[model samples]
Target: MLGPGAADVAFEVNGHPASVHVPPHHTLLDALRDELGLTGAKRVCDEGTCGACTVLVDGRPTYSCMTLAVACEGRSIETVEGLAHDGQLDPVQQAFIATDAYQCGFCTPGQIMSVVALLRANKAPTAEDVHRAVAGNLCRCGAYPGIVEAALRAARARRR
Candidate 1:
């Protein structure tokens, strides 16, 4: 049972119905990780500066840590876990692995999510566009070159 100030928020997650009972101030990140057991969105820099907690909300990349769970009611949330189907990774994910786009891997999920959003809109994005898309995600390992290559490769893979 939910206590005072707690409410149940129902939303679509990775095409599945998900419900979480949380207080008004509880972050979507917490609900996704704690209540829903979808931990692909990392908990780094809970303040939202780091994009490790990035998720796709209605196809737009959003920082889950900065978003309130209550605000997600009826919205669609997509995480890294949703990108794979039938044991096959999404093109973006495959590209990331092929290009070795990440190190330490803390920011990879967020970077991939951002790239996925970008690719949805522009399957033929330029390097500048890829860079712009992932600007919000910080990679301490400085893997920008590989990340950009992966984004472009993913775009190519999607086109073929």
Candidate 2:
């Protein structure tokens, strides 16, 4: 059914379809960073504890580090690279920049992805919901308040 060392596999990245020949065990993070040169999805705790590797698989936030590249067949994947439109940052990204919601900036992409998913699901999220949505993303910079504020601001902007 298998061999010790296979050549590689291929998968579509972002919206463009392509095939990459990576080892069968190579993770989506490896494929994205090494094969596709899409480094937006950071590889933090590969065990899935950290949200740094977050990406959208069909509009849903998923840990790219833990997800196998093979599992993504025929599915649309969205990364932080896709958030900008015509050189303009998405609204949540803009709010995060205005609010200074990140420091050191290592976790900002995951944070922004969480906010994007939240706003996509709830146009008006309560404070508790905002907190709950970002619970999984850990910001070592201790910028939780700013992150919350950015989320609220994004919610407001979406409503207007």
Give per-model TM-scores.
0.96, 0.91
TM-score of 1: 0.96
The global Cα lDDT (0 to 1) of model 2 is 0.83
- For model 1, how does the per-residue alpha-carbon lDDT over 69-157 read when each residue is reduced to its tens digit? 98899999999999999999999999999999998999999999999999999979999999999999999999989999999999999
lDDT of 2 by residue, 30-53 (tens): 888888898988988888887998
Kindly report which residue pairs in candidate 2 clash with one another.
Answer: 8-21, 8-22, 9-22, 10-20
Q: Find the 10 residues in a row with the least total lDDT in model 2.
A: 1-10
After best superposition, candidate 1 residue 78: deviation in angstroms?
0.4
Best TM-score among the predictions, by candidate number: 1
lDDT of 2 at 17: 78
Candidate 2: TM-score?
Answer: 0.91
How many steric clashes between backbone atoms does each model show? 0, 4
